[model samples]
Target: MTPPAITGQVALVEDDYTLVINRGTEAGVVAGMVFAVSSGTGQVITDPESGRELGRLSREKLRVRVFDVQPLFARAHTFAETDSFYGLLRIPFVATDDVVTIDVGDPVEAIAIEGMGYRKEANGY
Candidate 1:
């Protein structure tokens, strides 16, 4: 099935990892829904020569798992990444792991159902 349309923005990113989204049950958001966060309109790509439009650059920032759905707001937490990055270091080729945090005011869109790929391994492997 297709993912839900992006109809919300992150209202806040709590210290405890809980995120408050502007959309909730009224916007077809339900508990256990997973949302993906990105840079939103904050970044854009443009041709340097023409100074013309190219496209908005949005990279997957973080994933959130919704738990409490209110009328105008829902609570969630940074869960996992829809995409992971791995880097090789030097001759030894050490692996590098990167974790993206959902910053406040970032655009959030429903992307998957909860438990779809929930990881039980520690450190969210």
Candidate 2:
């Protein structure tokens, strides 16, 4: 029930469908923890005329369950799967689905943890 903290970034994704995150036991990451993975650099909104920065938009890419923990990293399984004929096609050679949403370098934060809000608005947190 510790306050939701910035855990880490997704460093890599194994071919076996495991996500390798930078946070680990030392950062309070533990088995059974769920992380809210971000889509990407996110969309940057700005003023059309002044070009002033308006805001950034981010979306929930996927949810992952941490099942293995190390001192420097953790391995997780995404809740969604890409396996249908369409899913399979996307997984192997496309960028039009949830599987494409998760990429290395995406932000990953523990969710459903104490202090972690269950729902997020369009604003990037």
Candidate 3:
């Protein structure tokens, strides 16, 4: 049987920085999943203590998933440089499944799962 359909939004994005994924049992991120990386151009103006947003400067869909997450922790490059980076985790085979992108301040979920093929290729086995 196929895996259940899953959907999520981009929860986090580290622009111009490398996202270090732990392939160990800690992080639950699996292979064959797609993530969306986005950015906001507008200024997020807000009160000092109240934390109330005064207004939005601008918003834009910077870039889509350019990197298909490999099974191991390697240096994955970014498509473009921006202020924010969001990771939307979703199973690709599941068409109906909703995808949730990760944004700033979101909890990190899932460890990177190293596929056998990827390991062999990387090690030249």
Candidate 4:
């Protein structure tokens, strides 16, 4: 996994709502890694001058805490925080008009780096 990454993804969600994320032993995934689940459309940015792609703007869906780990993946579940409402992140000047849901392709990003401590700002990523 890239050091710049809070690397992970939602691999499976149990009927009981347990989340299986795609990061494990080899990927340096361990118990207690906090993951932020996001499900929203991202806008691709391109350089207006040269038409080069810059980056994508994404939205945070929710947060999950890992309680177990294995060789291929890890299991996670949700918790509450003041700013996170199920998955709705508060963004200034941006209006979210659609409903979001937990799904197969939704990204599950780790909230902390290995040593850099926790990053609470979603836009910093």
Candidate 5:
């Protein structure tokens, strides 16, 4: 099945562990969506006259999924420290040459999800 497209800011990042995003269902987030983690590095896309390149936010494209979601109050303590949701994702695939890295307060984008064999549109969920 095609994955849904969602956008949110990165809340936290820890290699081989977990990556979290701020916006969730309250922000119209859903499960089974794929997210790409990026770093704040690269040519800045800006207007020549202004000489501003946005927020100079670079990121790494790390594919992740929305495994859990909780209300803001339910996650007040955690969200207070960081204004984002707790996203749990497992890294099952990685490139040998690609270095995996992420930082707190980055940006996340829900790309696409790979369809499962047992699930289909008509009779599957």
Candidate 6:
């Protein structure tokens, strides 16, 4: 049988910084795990020839690491990729003309369980 799907949504945002996801220990979530939040306005991709809906392509808003977890939820935050030399904060990578922040109810997906590959290709394999 197939395992249950592990998916969640952004439940809250604290002061426009901290984000809360709806999955937690009950869903196999642990601290230091990364979750990706995608924008809701995803463009639907379709097959040109058959005119069949293939999938939705959405821009990932940002990735957050969970620092706090409870039975039913988790809190997370993200830090900008800083300049090592001068410690300057860089602009958001996915910056759009209008929005660059995580909004409540955005879809969140776990970034765990990278699949099989040539072992030599991975570092320290």
Ranking by lDDT: 2, 6, 4, 1, 5, 3
Q: lDDT value for candidate 5?
A: 0.50
Itemize residue pairs with steric clashes in candidate 1.
none
User: Candidate 2 — which residues are off by over 4 angstroms?
Assistant: 47-50, 80-101, 113-125
lDDT of 2 by residue, 1-125 (tens): 54556458899998545789999888888786778788767689999999999888877777677879899899987543345564444332233543454678998878743234443422444
Q: Which residue window of length 10 is worst by lDDT in model 2?
A: 90-99
In terms of lDDT, the poorest run of 10 residues in model 1 is: 86-95
User: Which structure is stronger by lDDT: 1 or 4?
Assistant: 4
- After superposition, the stretches of candidate 3 with alpha carbons farther than 4 Å from their true spots are 1-25, 40-42, 45-51, 54-125
Q: 1 or 4, which is superior by TM-score?
A: 1
What are the per-residue Cα lDDT tens digits for candidate 3 across 1-125? 42332222343345433333323112333543222333334578998989999876533322232233444432222232223232233221221354433344322222112222212111133
Candidate that would win on TM-score: 6
For candidate 1, write residues 41-111 as lDDT tens digits.
Answer: 65778899999989887776666678898988999875434343321211211223864556667887777
For lDDT, the strongest prediction is 2
Model 6 per-residue lDDT tens digits across residues 105-125: 899876633232212211223
User: How many clashes does the backbone of model 6 have?
Assistant: 0
Question: For each candidate, what TM-score against the reference?
Answer: 0.66, 0.67, 0.25, 0.65, 0.54, 0.69
Report the CA-based lDDT of candidate 3 relative to the real structure: 0.33
TM-score of 2: 0.67
lDDT for each candidate structure: 0.68, 0.70, 0.33, 0.69, 0.50, 0.70
lDDT, candidate 6, equals 0.70
Clashing pairs in 6: none
Q: Write candidate 4's Cα lDDT for 1-125 as tens digits.
A: 33555576788886334678988877877776778888645889999999999988877876677778999899877654434564345221212574346787688777763335665656764
